[model samples]
Target: RVMYTITKWIEHKLGLKVNATKTHITRPNKLKYLGFGFYYDTKDKKYCARPHASSIQRFKRKLKQLTIRKNTMALNERIRQLNQVIRGWINYYSICNMKTHMMNIDKHLRTRLRVIIWKQWKVPSKR
Candidate 1:
């Protein structure tokens, strides 16, 4: 009933149409908003926020573009660019209680960096 009233209010009072296909009525913990997912942490006995899987995948895709092997950008310049992007992303998502996810991403990022360095070292003697 409340949902119907709110939908009507949005359409009539606010002069905005609500898309039934996109509308969802669910608990906060079951909803994803702005790339973040909320869930009840049984161990902590509290609600927590974390990046959704899709959000993480999107970040990884962006990182891959930045770190692609044939970019031709100098190593220091590439690192500087990567740092700028990573800092902004971390600052935004730090509100989420996702230490494990962050750690895993860090590991994956390090591996990518190693691969980039290896590719740069084309000669076997350089390795």
Candidate 2:
């Protein structure tokens, strides 16, 4: 069978002698999943007898980097929420101080008005 011959060829190229106990003949999950001899070329659209091991390693490394990036993004979002709460508290304190100062001025103005009216009408000061 062509498949058997190809498998034998692959084992020979890899310097791995075929052992019946170790080898298992299985159907391809998909045409691409079959690990046979194949060479791929990006420039000329060619697929030859040998495949590149570098492609497999590169894919694994890229997946690792993506997982790290996702964790960092989640941490940054949590820090952003904490900073927003701190800023809200700061703004609330500033407004409260301003309101207290305004109330003190309002009380002083009312006391001065009462004093002036009492002097004009010859009425005794209440306090």
Candidate 3:
């Protein structure tokens, strides 16, 4: 003898197409027409206003924080590389420039080198 069992099957599906460029949600009060002025009113009835949703406000706040974090990380990495280059230059000067220091070597060269290095590192000020 054999025992039989029955089972039910279910299927579900959903589709989403995200267009980032058109995602902005505009509010009614912001709309304006030149000849019509802000809006039209019939008796006490009028094209009225509605405030932005709380979710949009929170999303903007979080987006700003993320942007700041990304910029800080990029700047920190550039500073780290600049420090390494400066250390190499100091070693070169100690081994070579000092041994070959000559009056004929232009003082302007040192100033130029300093400026170039500062610019490359994106430093704020020369002094």
Candidate 4:
């Protein structure tokens, strides 16, 4: 009932159409806006938005692509490209709370870089 009334009010007063299919009444934490979702920050005692898991996964995918061993790109060039992507992404999502996510991505990225370096070295010496 409330949803219908609100939708009607928007259509009538706001002079706009509300698509029923797209409208969903849900908790803030359940909704994701621009790759970010609300999370409760215990330290601040309030809700804060953070990059969603899907968003982080997408970022990791990019890192994986850049760090792929068979790419044959020079190490310096690959590092530069990786830095460019990381900088832009960080700046855009800087406002969101994502310390833990960053840490996890760091670990995964380090492992990928190690694999890349190993491949670049071409051969390993038995110690």
C-alpha lDDT of candidate 1 relative to the true structure: 0.88
Cα RMSDs, all models: 2.7, 28.6, 25.1, 2.5
TM-score winner:
4
Q: Which stretches of candidate 1 lie over 4 Å from their true place?
A: 8-21, 124-127
* Candidate 3 TM-score over all chains jointly: 0.19
Question: Relative to the true structure, how large is the alpha-carbon lDDT of every model?
Answer: 0.88, 0.44, 0.37, 0.88
Candidate 2, clashing residue pairs? 38-49, 38-50, 39-48
Ranking by lDDT: 4, 1, 2, 3
Q: Pick out the ten consecutive residues of candidate 2 with the lowest summed lDDT.
A: 28-37
Across 1-127, the per-residue lDDT of candidate 2 in tens digits comes to: 8757867887888877776655666533212322222434467675543222343344335433433422434434544643565355335434222334335534653454455444445646644
Model 4 C-alpha lDDT per residue in residues 6-122, reported as the tens digit of each score: 999999999998889889788878988898889777898898989888888899899989998889998899999999999988998999988888998889888888888878776
Poorly placed runs, candidate 2 (over 4 Å) = 1-97, 123-127
Q: Give the lDDT of residue 123 in candidate 3.
A: 50
Q: For residue 85, what is the lDDT in candidate 2?
A: 51
Query: How would you encode candidate 1's per-residue C-alpha lDDT over 10-36 as one tens digit per residue?
Result: 999999989988897898777888989
lDDT of 2: 0.44
lDDT of 3 by residue, 1-127 (tens): 1111111111112233434454333444554322111233466576632212342244335433433422444545644554565455345333222212222222533444455455556756634
